[model samples]
Target chain A: MARLTTPLTDFYAVIPAGGIGSRLWPLSRADAPKFLHDLTGSGSSLLKDTWDRLAPLAGEQRVMVVTGRAHRAAVEEQLPELADLNVVLESEPRDSSAAIGLAAAILEKREPGVIIGSFAADHVIKGTRFFNMAVAEAVEAARAGFIATIGIVPTEPAIGFGYIHATEETELEGAPSALKVDSFVEKPNAHTAEEYVESGDYLWNAGMFITKAAVLLEELAKTQPELHAGVVALAEVWDDHAKRGPAVDKIWPTLKKIAIDYAVAEPAAAAGKLVVIPGEFDWDDVGDFASIAKLHSSGYKKDLAILGEGARVLSDASSGILITDTGRTIALVGVKDIVVVDTPDALLVTTTANAQKVKSVVDALRISGRDDVL
Target chain B: MARLTTPLTDFYAVIPAGGIGSRLWPLSRADAPKFLHDLTGSGSSLLKDTWDRLAPLAGEQRVMVVTGRAHRAAVEEQLPELADLNVVLESEPRDSSAAIGLAAAILEKREPGVIIGSFAADHVIKGTRFFNMAVAEAVEAARAGFIATIGIVPTEPAIGFGYIHATEETELEGAPSALKVDSFVEKPNAHTAEEYVESGDYLWNAGMFITKAAVLLEELAKTQPELHAGVVALAEVWDDHAKRGPAVDKIWPTLKKIAIDYAVAEPAAAAGKLVVIPGEFDWDDVGDFASIAKLHSSGYKKDLAILGEGARVLSDASSGILITDTGRTIALVGVKDIVVVDTPDALLVTTTANAQKVKSVVDALRISGRDDVL
Candidate 1:
């Protein structure tokens, strides 16, 4: 942690911002998705928080945010210090691989050997000191030409996220704790998640990757040649500043819709060109109201967690979350683990046990022709 | 039911409207009560429903409604056909004894041998044909010099309502089914309610009473002389039209705040002067969300019962009542027997099992100084 303050001048943080998070229901809609919300109750949107976390390490010049065009204005409004060149507006979604690959290609063209770390815009991370230290180590490992990922030390058997299997006793010169990557696995059931926790060799894949920009593009060129050529062709003309828009409009939609985990990370791990650096920081995707409630409880002692401003609540024997932004008072009685989301146009009531099924509510509404609320 | 179509010309119906219904919070508030809302999902309000149910039996001119002075304007708005003189406005709350006693005394003065029936404005009565037949028989028994009460045939062992104990059938002309009421019992325990239901002698005391106005006043005079005298003095000037307001303002607050059951019906039943005509009508006090949900299900087969207009509901695996007038769409997933009430300033979420405890939400609001919402 002591050697972490010098600032990684060559580091570029790339934020791939997507996902509607339907499991969060009325709060996270299609037009105004999860990355745009202030899920931490910190009075700042998650996109801005992501910028805040990254800008300190890479400065605004090297910090980049790639989001859909619908959210570009909101992202600009939230991050007042962000320069226009650092923000990439997608014409449409083409999944994580295309989004992150384009950022890696552009930064590699901007400054070859520039170290880039991609972090999701909607995730919450605590213990900034430990995160800074882990990123410093990952940057050191990335300089050794290995695509380095910061794996979170598992605190519980969370069945909501993907896990990374790291083999022991392998290290990079500058990073003492860097280990060889074995595989990237899917979200497990409760029993398998518990077994993974007990193994002590697995960590949660935070979808955070640190590597030299040239190394990421080289790997993409080796595995997905067409995708690499398309992004690299756009990145070459991006700084010409005149042909950038036309070049992106022509080539962006043709890129494949696939996640980076499937396109690059898994194959690289299988080929022994991937490395894992474990991070000791608290993180959550804020997947549902239950996760937000748990995050909210860490700040207060009340059994009930109330979000939004100036909304009064009177609850009894209830453990749940009540969310309202319209200044409407919510009164809950004799309900446990219930989720009440009160907005101006919609209201949703269910329990935490049905957290994952909240997407079904959106699906049902879509099927019922409630597109206005959606 | 065939003998019920002819109008009961001499029967004056008195509707005593009160009770804020704290158990149905956010929907039932201090400024606007349950009786003013359309809890039935019908186009009209409960007060108007009460008027609609009574107008066919006793013409609009003979129907009387007694309510608080604060609700006088709303009552007038809902019951536009009601004559100005027929609306008895209480200066303040003096409970049912004084409210109904004044209506009875006034109707007795307006028409000398008038038979008056007191029905609650907030109760729901189905099977109008059978209800009319029962009231006709009760009126006949009332004409025979006995105070008559309608006893609802219990369909379940509900422990929420009082039971009426009736003895062997007595001889009454034109009222063959009328039996002498032995006593009026309070709400019983679950076991006691089951026993009372099995005994075949007990019926639910629906708080509906019919009698000659003169007989009711005389019984009131015998049991509670001071209360009877105060109401009688007020009634004497009530039809003076000019002096009615000043007279009621002077004498109203002096009367005791006691229910009519304790003041006259219970004592009269013990003295063998009370008779019960068993009614085979579907009756509900509309006590809580469960009752309203049940009433709603009988009309529509949807798992969720939505009350009022302009509420779009998408529910899955849920059965309960959703009351919203704010035009907000409510999406419920995986919850059963849930009660969600969405208003402009407040919202409430609970289940049918906790219906009776909703008053505690109001109590908690009062304790927490949220009087604006309450």
Candidate 2:
């Protein structure tokens, strides 16, 4: 916990860490957003989990975090072992594309021919052994001149994620499950998701992408030429240490706001230059309260998913999640499929069926000028 | 606020306050039961409401509250105007029959012809004008050597309360609405409740009984002789302040536990000496969280019934109640008919339909040795 000590690896891991996670409101807020919360009941924040997952592969010095300027202190505090130079700070949000592109550029400039894998700071991935195996395959595929995405084999007919279609096996060495990407589809309806699951060709696009730093820049240059040049310029000044502030303030605001998917993945797939490492590891985005409920209700809780510091008393209650950070005893009676999140300043009650619509409550509160709560 | 100043009526009022209100658990606890809580959100507790309704007719000196010894301080603190000698504190709970009979015997010993009306401490009643009129009629009927019970005209076919079957219209000169009670029936099933509501001869037995102290003692002597004689002997010693404690210590523990309705009302009805004064008034026992929700979902909140302090931001929620004493902001999404009660140490979440089953939760917690929350 005090210092970072691990064997060195060539490839750097980049975490694009920013999002309010408005759908998990009351628990997730602008001041302390999704990445800062321990939504998975794993006793650490999602940002910390991301660090723990990547640190073994890349070492603490090689694992870079790209986050908003407002969250720089929090990121540094959470990842105490993170090297000062490895923390990439943006003046304001420019979306996933610019954030990850900046990290790729910095790593490419510092060490030539370096490979980097971009992961979001607020995702939950289980089975570290399987994840490490998939990442190793992804690294091999990335070095073989392909933009590699770690596509999780779909466990259920989930419509909440984009689907990566793997068409045929590739002849990539050291990566047995590497497949040529057919296309990437947007989140589908239930029927389409069911069809995708049944077809056995579709994997959930977990937004994990491994690529040679120069290759990603090359693809970015072709798809989003201006954004690529801007990140490259910021990366050059970022390495100078003293000039990062002025450089970020000048270029980050002008960078076109877009996600990495629209900026690189879609175009790379269309050009037939994308390969996917099919990963059977259990993964979840922890997208909403419903997902968290699912995580806790798996084994320990057959009926009630209790998280944080509190006791629970259930009477005729079957399925629900109760999260209490305020040390309050929760009693549930005759309710099912419910979610109750209790904090000091705010409390939330909703059913898992309506979890996706929680963002509307945050929006409503914002409209009413209750920014103090939001 | 300080002292009693009203002129006393001939009949004294006895508030038999002892039930823990287990149905309204977490909010109503053994330490602070329903009578001590402001279930109506009207700024005063139910016990205070009962006193407000009765203090006009019987001065504070004449109003006696018979409660368990543990609640003596709470009762005295809430009713500061009440005379200390008028507070009857029992060593332990012995049910309504002993609690009320003791009050009657004490009043009868103070004055041989005294009429005393026993009222429960936790029922909510609206229209003070109607309540005053009913009490006036019942008092007149009580002086006519009949046990007068105020039966509420049923507004709905509720299976939650006992029924009073009145057969013949009585010719009591001052009490025009006095009807000869054929019998007192226990809480019936839905089918019988609906049938009785349509029959136009049955009224809800609200357990408001007015009788000559001697008549109540005489009836208790018939049905529960041992309990009646014990309370009478205790009353005799109670007049002498010094001997009261030893007398209660000796006799209170020997009194048999029973409800006044079973010991007196039912047996007196069989003897053709019970008369019911039918009174129509808005009344609720505040039996559960569902009743409290109905109270608040009256004029403004057509959907969400909110009680106590704090603010709520709701989305797609209807027909639910949220009770929060803490100043936490509550956000509820897409839930209907839900009951959420939040306190400093405990929380309860249930549906209004299942509000009656909250005691099971308390039992569960107690079984788990969580008495601190209960």
Candidate 3:
């Protein structure tokens, strides 16, 4: 459980993937989300690939996971070698702050000085060497008592992700160590997103973070006392996790529903205690179906059937079958900038312009009590 | 098997249903034809229904059928009580006349004075009472030595059926005997069909006929000697049908390919021997899917999902869900006059207007070589 690099103690990679991804409808339901799916056909899940890139520096047992009770079996199935004790299962969905707090409390018991590097289980990262190098640099900055958050080098003016403002760099250790985060910006409209990307100092907040467990707890105690108290309470019972598990679950539902950035990082940065770890890795949160288009080297043409030139990527083309009964043949005809999912039972045809609005279909189905579709 | 009814002996009924219907695609393929399908939902076939209506008049043993070699088993399955000796199976498909001649030759031996009445195996007759009365009248005309073909009383100017012109009728022996058929017409264009329907003298040439076997043979001898010679050759060894059956097949392929109407009836009317017996019965050919809509009372939303209407003859309201998928749900929203056939391999979403054109989809699938869908 002690975070130690082969050369030096660099970072402890922790994945939090507990959200029920109901937006994917039939393919990704409450029982299984997009992270567990081999949607890319690479024979590896996003979580599996994320772990493979991190294990070299974090060491095998140094990497841990915080997932939901529903996904525990799936997580174990994907990472069989991942020890059952290292994988933390949330009794119910509470939010990112509680998840991060749970991870920090668990790791603090085994080791005191270890830095926690957190990433989402469903993020698609390209260029592992660059990401590993960045995490190592962030680890060094964390030991120097700065809460380090990875700011991804922006590839597009994507309005889907939050952005960070960088003021000036601090001379620390390893690669580029730290920068004072001027402010945190929420996901903006297209025009504002374009402005942010054009600004040289702004980077997309990757949600990946590196910080000493004790330092994070200290910051949380000052800024978000309620969250800090809940984490402390769970830490007391965590020593005998098997016995006190039910008692911990009984208290979980009352915890504040908040993201880590809102409860700690943003407020900490406001009080002059935040640092930006400039991530050199090519990264994507893989936010939606359209984002999957960026995974291939050919930019949506060679790997996909991009009909009407840059408008659509038609996957599942086999034989000369332009139209099939929803399995192998799909035709993206006369449609431009739309996400058309052709499943056996349901056909979701909507503009990529309205990609975020896909959740509305699930919402409407839920309202109509159509659980069979939802 | 005597044809005597009360004091007189006269007519016969023959059915020919041998062509394997491939147009219906998956439901009706190379091995199964239209007559064998229980399309009416009564779990009784079109052939069986035709036999049921014809049985009382023709007498069970006298109601003969001529079919291709492949369909003999299906015929036996539908009519289980049929003796092996009563059924006639053709060696090959050479046209209706050859099939008829094969039956005629066999019946001529068992009974010398038999008058054969022929009908299609897969036709629908709505007015059975009128149909039975018409056949009785035709039998008297056949006894008077007139070769009688039933002219269906026209209900519509349907371009799908051929027409017959009955110029004059004869009254003899307390029955309306026959009409001199002036001319025969092929399936005409809409305008001509409308004119034929309004002309008051024309009736649909239903491809059914009643005539003395001896008179039919004499007519065949004068009109088509080649056909008559084939029949004679087939009859010469009719006593040893089992032994001579192979020799009969060898000579059959050499005979001219022709329909009975073209070979005998059209030419026989030049001598005024071909006469029309007006069938007062409701008759339907059931040529296409559109015809199935007729079995129901109304063509529109009478039995379908009707709004603010309660006089439904049948309604799939209240959990009458026709679901094909275990994984997904089907929603029928604001739609009527539609047939939703959901197959595992393919789905048909079309209106009953387009139901006849479903054959075009089968044709398209054949062209695409999507045999799984077919």
Candidate 4:
């Protein structure tokens, strides 16, 4: 993979940052979502990390973020270099279809045929060189008028993510490694995931999509015309601050809530208009403590991984991950694969195997009307 | 079982309050040991509960506490009804032999042939009627010049406690249920403990000893003459406040460090001067979180036992014990048999199977010079 020093021409980056991240409750809350948190233990937050990764490829002036109004201040605070016009705020979440669709419509209105790449703000990526290489190839495939998605090389038979099946028979011009997508599949069960990993043609869909703004809008118009019309109407008035508020207030609520994968990628793949770019970069969504444990396992001491600044922890015959935000000293004894998240106001204890079940705790708290903690 | 309303005549209660209780770390610290904590969630400290239980049997005036100098203020604060003369404090710990012997020597000096029953301050007991019946019968055996011990009926093959072997062939005259002690054994391995439980002749020693103060001192004179002489010397001037400090400071350091089980009980049992009284009351030493879990299992919700006042906890498919002192909300998800102790300065996470290993965490903290948390 070659590292590109110069920014790609006519390329715009759109970050869709919205999710309650209930599985990471107490650490990732409703008001403070996962993207705003420095879950990687890096000095910068996930949002800032995403910005840093994309700024070299898309340039600072061409980067945009679409987030809920509640997180607008946090996004702006985390990325001070972001232009005010590029900060698109939603009154409420309408899911990925509206978020990315509106960004594509706005970018298309700003500059015709602008190649826009949409990436999630909360995902963690390593190997910036490979990431840049894959994005550049995806951009080339996008310039040839095809919706291109970066399919992450399968590292394990992970059932937590959707898969993209691509055939090597048809390769796109200019994009040397691009392959024709056969289909987009939903999250599979353990047996199916194992088969998919063994097949070598399946890749984990990391939700990285690159396409010309016109091409994405065209696909959305074909699959979800009502949502496409709602976004296009809002995009026409988005630059006009005077008309933007009323337009969003009227049109945003009327848009059908759907994910971009379902609204465009699946339909486009079915119609033979989508291509997959193989991405060899290491990626993690940081979806649960198990993902977190895997990310920080390299820094484990006595088989225990501890995350936080100046955290005091003592472990004896213990193998676990401790995420502490408080000044209290945590002691672990004779535990294995445990996850302890200790915050000032709340504490969560579970195991890495049951990391996905933490959402039930949040559900319980919500049902019991503990909105104060939620 | 019968309950006695009136205080027993000529009967005195001695409480030996000591031990760091490292197994309950973060909840029990060196400065504040287990006896000072309200571990049972009964709104009273263990020492206070011991005083309340014994005050009815032995009048408040006849109750005595022997603890380290550091815990004197806490003991006094928890038991305001305790007389100043009865609050005996050792400058440093010298094991139970010295602590209990000094109390016996002092009571003998105040009144010869006075019957004193020594009970630990940290043990939990239920069925007050059965406990009173056992204690009354033990007192009768004590009056017959035999060292009487309340032996708990075996509920399980618990290897954590010592056992007393009692023969059903010989019985005491005054105490109808009293049996002759064959021998007292130290803590055994799992196989031996299982065998002891199956034999039906072995009983768990709850360390409840009832004997005449003069007889205890006489027995101590035979087995441990030096310790007996030292306690007698300290007891001579214990009432004189002006001379007490210098006497304790001089004699305490020279006293032998030995547990009463080794110095008195084992030797007396071998000499056929010990008797065991069956106690059917539910008793727990509260040795670790496992014991704490068993003691409070009846109040468990969803197989989880919680011990704290006004603690906010949410459990989802979790079976464990949570002992929290902080205002933080503790949420347990998909964890089984876990033990979480959350305090202001320190937090502890372990399992009921590994509860005893918590002492190793304290040891590590001490070795690492983290005395502030210890």
Q: Which candidate tops lDDT?
A: 4
Cα-based lDDT at residue B167, candidate 2:
72
Candidate 1 stretches greater than 4 Å from native = A1-3, A299-302, B298-302
Worst 10 residues of 1 chain A by lDDT: A1-10
The TM-score that candidate 3 achieves is 0.60
True contacts kept of 3: 0.10
For candidate 2, what's the TM-score of chain A, rounded to 2 decimals?
A: 0.94
TM-score of chain A of 4: 0.97
Who is ahead in TM-score, 2 or 3?
A: 2
* lDDT pick, better of 2 and 3: 2
> How many residue pairs clash in each candidate at the backbone level?
0, 0, 1, 0
Using DockQ, rank the candidates from best to worst.
1, 4, 2, 3
Worst 10 residues of 4 chain B by lDDT: B167-176
B175-285: candidate 1 lDDT, tens digit per residue = 788999999999999999999999988999999999999999999999999999999999989878799888877788789889999998998898889999999999999
**Model 1: lDDT of residue B90:** 85
Worst 10 residues of 1 chain B by lDDT: B1-10
Best by TM-score: 1
CA-lDDT, candidates in order: 0.88, 0.87, 0.68, 0.91
Where does model 2 exceed 4 Å of error? A1-9, A41-44, A68-81, A166-170, A173-176, A223-226, A299-302, A310-312, B1-8, B59-61, B68-85, B299-302, B313-315
Residue A7 miss distance in model 1 (angstroms): 1.1
TM-score for all predictions? 0.95, 0.91, 0.60, 0.95
